[model samples]
Target: MDRTTPRPGLRAQLLRTKPVDQIVSEAGHGTGGPASMRRSLGLWQLTALSIGASLGTGIFVVLGESVPLAGPAVVVSFVLAGFTALLSALSYAEMAGAVPVAGSSYSYVYATVGEFAGWLCGWCLLLEYGVSVAAVAVGWGQYVADVVHAVSGLTLPAWTVQPPGSGGVVNLPAALVVVGAVLLLVRGAQESAAVNAAMVVVKLVVLALFCAVAFTAFRAGNLTPFAPLGAAGATAAASRLFFSYIGFDAASTAGEEARDPRRDLPRAIVLSLVVITAIYCLVALAAVGARRWTWFDGVEVALVDILREVTGQTWVGVVFSAGALVSIASVVLTVLYGQTRILFSMARDGLAPALFGRLDRRGVPVLNTVVVGGAVAVLAALVPLGALADATSIGSLAAFALVNVSVVVLRRTRPDLPRTFRVPLFPLTPLLGAAMCVLLALNLGTGTWIAFGAWTLVGVAVHLGYGRHRSRLAVPAPVPAREPR
Candidate 1:
């Protein structure tokens, strides 16, 4: 056996693992030729990115859908989902600090699990980030309609603002917002982070206003039958509500762009989750407490309507809708940014087309941004919000579960690696994280599972046809020696 030659066999090729040091080294060397991603994000900017990506959809849009499922117990549903996210977040923080690369869990899994698994995880992330961006964009469009109506007393044509089957020929506003975010992303990462940070602040303030006003109308009687549907309902709602926390890992995707990823990535992930969970709980409590849970059904802008009803003041709702407009757009921006970076990482590793790896002078992946943003916009224009949200939850749950497993695997496989942050309780924490991910995923609709399976099959075909042969780790056969004439 030649010591230098890669072992033969499909199994060996599939399980080929990249070394952790090599992963870190490639990132440091600027894998994108002359225009590598710049490290401009500090602790707060990274935290803001996570919060900005996370705070929008659940509170502004999905709360309406989730409340009906869980009734007033929806607050509990939020907590359950947040707890699940926190567990997985701990694992993400650990691996992110240890690896600190652009691909988030995709890179971590490659270093711990194998190339094929990493490719699949990255595929799941694509489903998560890309679809979530479209979902959030649709939510943004809802608020855009509301704002236009509030300002002009004229409802935009339903066909222009709503997805197909919901009366719209095309959701133009949703598509427009996705395009706007892409333009911002093309400028530079630092500029995008700064804009996102401002929007996050606005989001927090708007949520605070909602909580204060909604509490004024709170009645203890509204809590009479908290769990109108039962435990099963709450569990199901939590499965969908998991979409709310999808962007909590946004910071981890920016590992290569963080100024101090080893320390700041861990802190940003934990801090953002804690603050986001608290805000979500408070907002959910206020929402259901102020109004009967049944009233939430079919209300796309629940918070705006709640404010309008509670104060009998249309202006109040208008103000909140404006904030939501900015908030959801911020999410579309950050999640889109995360998706582009994930593709950039995969492309650099030869798992994706090289177009995704190219960057301009300012270190922005221009073509990658346009392609991803255009796809998300088309989805937003065509797909209904409910289906997009559910699909995103399933994909996110799978990616998170893999992250937890990667943490445990890496800890055992490379004890000598320096870990700036470690998941407490060792194997127990990560194991519980994986278990919780499965629990939530099982509660999702059968339709989502079917969609995920289809997506996985497509990913497998892409990998076998393209990535397997092109991967940097795929060894070439030794050329036949030529006999001397």
Candidate 2:
């Protein structure tokens, strides 16, 4: 800001934008101190991190929930959902290359839109990442119970394994898995990414095994009368299945830790989305083709059950459940990692409490990781996340819509900005990306809209009460004559 100019009023304070050059500079070191994140992540590790975050419960668990809605046409639902994700991913790749930062869309919006819009996007991200972590953890407990029963002939008491709303005293396993992920995160980013990469390999092999076995029993007749509920039903299922693609942007959150964020972030984001969508479609096809879609209703461990029914072998189901256990745990870890980093970025900008940006000796946001993990664990233990998938989808969709808007705004405002990646078709791609996100969000139920509204109101209050006043932009500084290109 120019010191000679008069202090701007409230509206200016609310609408001030962060410069992209400042964001890139901050990515290389901490904003408040000399301590910085360790830049150890490479392209493959970033791809694996994204796959680990995204390629979980959506296929292994939510498929059961969606199959009943779309019937055998759930395969088409996956394709529709994947297409929606792809449009936004192209826009994400472009913005990520131009303005690499840990806040993902939140930072992109702050740099391109303004402070108020950025805060709202960050708020939505909080809902998307934090709640999804708990929702995925809850799914993990179900597979844990299934694995234990299948391998040991021991049925864990429902009171201990299920959440309160689901008739259990507490979800013990859900909380424990979150804690396990926190432990791994505290060790450091590179170590955690290495473990996540290994888990990604295990899960891919597990899914392949499932496809090989399930296809052995595939019957073309099973896919007859696909979309029994009609195109409307397939669209509805696509809206829900969009949750399956939520973490494809997980790679963008690693901007601060990527060895070459400008290059790797865009490639990792698009590459991971492509891989995840293919696997999701392939898995959905196999599950529906192997068994009647009607049988999927109310089945939590649908894939494991499909294998059991197709082979009539308990060991096959046991193996699948064991793989899912590893699979879901990976989701918990990566999503939680993303949650902490989003907060870390916000804290640095003074939108969130400074504690969230604090680093440990290993350059890990240890306290932030623990705080986020603990909250998610508690939420998983108590809340029955029956509606959380829709809630998460709405939040993510809203953030993605703003990301597309950000890309357009940045192009107009800073045409000289360098970009390693550009969305093909120019405005057409980003326009469709924004339109698809809004369309998918509209497909969600009224309950999801109500919840999203309440969350947004809370965010507004927080911003007005705390963020606006404490914002770094609120303080006067030597104004840069020009922004970096």
Candidate 3:
């Protein structure tokens, strides 16, 4: 059987499957074809990848929006969201280690559940990462505006700061920040990771400064009645804050590049989750302790409210806003990185156009990075994503569920595979992880499911129209010849 040979029929083409060994081997080779995607990540860089992705948008942009829902108990919401993320992170860690591939869950599911499911997962991830990048870029635009106004008392033009629905032609700053990340990524993985690490440190230091500065004004009276809306409200807030946890699996996207995929990927995933969760909790506590929850409700930049409390100087506010800008920029970089690499893997496997998988001499997917950045920049400039955050969350949670189930299935089928990191409780961990992801997705409401359903329908159409027979894996591998008797 030859790889380029067409399958016999439509059904065969649509359902064509690749064995785990074949998929893993191709991924290990780094090219899967003529163009080779480079592997240049280590544990620290991988940690920066996840931290840079998930830590930006939530604390700076969404926390104020969530305060009305959970009151002072927003702190509890951060903890709960961390728990859900931990479950999914464990599953991703195990699979990334054992599979050691760039596609993340997309490659893992292809090996376990067949082609259609794999394509569906990859499609969902595309939605997740794309929206995440746009959403964070928009947030970055706002912070940048704040910093500029703080320094010079001159606001960025409204047309450049907001989308059309908000009475602006385009989010120019948002699109610009996305382009900045594009330039860094096009340089090379090592360059991108180095910048990401530096930004991660900046974000963390700013967050710590925020906590310390805010605690100086802490009165404790604000939390007297913490659960204003009750446990239900806290749970709802957790569902919303789960948006912040989207990028832990970003480390899994670097599985092929990780210096020790089996050891480093899992550690990076888990460590990033823990550090981000801790930061969220501390900041949430400090913010609530400093001001009543009602004060933060509908607030855009909640950290500024506390940063202004600096008795001696006003520079703290400027520093905090600048830190937020750096954080959001890093997030756009890391998530965009994940998006292109995953698509690269898909292209290599014949699911996407070969152009997307093409790598330049430096082993970077230059064209692919530019294309992804351009699409997301347009999305940030043209689309109002305020209402679509839930839609993005649903897509991410669905992909997480698929990954958790893939882990269990792969365990049964490929038990002999080398796994430096294994899910702790076997069936229990994955079962719970998959269930939690579905539970969170359901909490995203009916609108999200409708949007997801529509996107998935389009994906099915694309697969049938282009990816069906075009997939390189549709043809089976040839059998070895027996020795002459």
Candidate 4:
């Protein structure tokens, strides 16, 4: 096969041969077998998984940084970010219903746009999901340390608990969390989902308690300097909170496991967004109202601090810290699941090493999970939380832009396909989604852009050197036709 000839009508080959149903069944079951792992997830479990992935350290920890920038208007920023996410979710719901695959945006982009764009989207998502797991693990370690000190009156050495830039030797607790989640994933999806659901409940209960206590001490005067830095500040804060909205797409990634993906995927995506955004708004309101926004500077445990101030109760801080720990663990587990499945899709399509696509005796991608977990653990142990968060945001924003564009492209090219859910405004909604993602990307600082660009260059290099040569669609140049399930 010639490597530079654009794969001889590869787009048509993929479009005609790989239908939505075929892709969903392949991901849900196995390629060369009858029944693989049990399909235990229904719509409710699926929705909970999305919520578990979306509501995490981003909400509990990042608010401290955003509040100082937007004041009480951080509430407004939440709304703006939620609106942007809602738009993208609508587009995703449509495509997920239309395609029903494991790779989420990558699969959607491939079926709609082309092979190269799909590879790029998948590569960007690797950074988004893998880096996020590491960042959340770091946050989990801080919360766990705080909980231990509050209950036992004994503290671990700072050198062992903090990341390098934070003046620590290594982040032991963070690395442990990543390792633990990796082990859980190797067991199978059903077991992992059960654990994730329990963690989600714990996190929600803690946040609800914190909100109740903080609202009691709410002071109207704290909101006086709302939008202190004006629209620019609001935009910047929205960009930051945008990170909080990253996991809503997890609902779409589980298309294969969804009971009725064409119908359920869209519902789960929108429902998760609504539920998470509502919780975030209330949390933001309580945090700002509990104390002056100016006092949030240098604060890591924003909710715990608010609870401590509101009730003058040290126990409340301990409880909130416990919740934060559980929340971060759940985030790591679910994001790692999304990442491994994406690599599985890439491997199956011959875009990556076959090892990543192989399922173990438990019908789980054990090797891919271990590889991703080990990489993230190294990052968590060595990198600063701030740097990790910035890189995650950049990659997530790029992926979001690609997904939004993919939605528009698919609608134009495949109008006759049965769509379980559709974006109401057609081109308008998708265009807005793309524009919002670009605006958020612009709000990121120069350092973040440089990091993002460097990572993208690496992805480009991998594609040119290896992916282009191994892609199945490019190898034999199969004729385009929708494959039967």
Q: Candidate 4 — which pairs collide?
A: 13-480, 16-481, 16-482, 17-481, 17-483
For model 1, what is the alpha-carbon lDDT of residue 302?
Answer: 90
Which one is best on lDDT? 1
Better TM-score candidate (1, 4): 1
Query: On residues 1-485, what C-alpha lDDT tens digit does candidate 1 reach at each position?
Result: 23344555789878999999989988833345676778999999999999999999888999999998999999999999999999999999999899999899999998989999999999999999999999999998999999999989999998999888988899998999999999999998899999999999999999999999999999988876999999999999999999999999999989888999999999999999999999999999998999998888888889999899989999999999998999999999999999999998998889999888888877788999999999999999998899999999999999999999999899889999999998999899999999999999999989999999999999999999999888988866566665668
- With a 3 Å backbone cut-off (N, CA, C), the pairs that clash in candidate 2 are none
User: CA shift at 232, candidate 3, in angstroms?
Assistant: 2.5
In candidate 2, what are the lDDT values of residues 138-205, reduced to their tens digit? 89999999989988899999998988778898989999999999999999989999999999998999
Q: Which ten residues in a row have the lowest lDDT in candidate 2?
A: 1-10
10 residues in a row with least lDDT, candidate 4: 10-19
lDDT of each: 0.92, 0.91, 0.85, 0.83
Candidate ranking under TM-score, highest first, comes to 1, 2, 3, 4
The parts of candidate 1 lying over 4 Å away from their true place are 1-7, 28-32, 477-485
Query: What's each prediction's clash count?
Result: 1, 0, 0, 5
User: Residue 59, candidate 4: how far off, in angstroms?
Assistant: 1.7
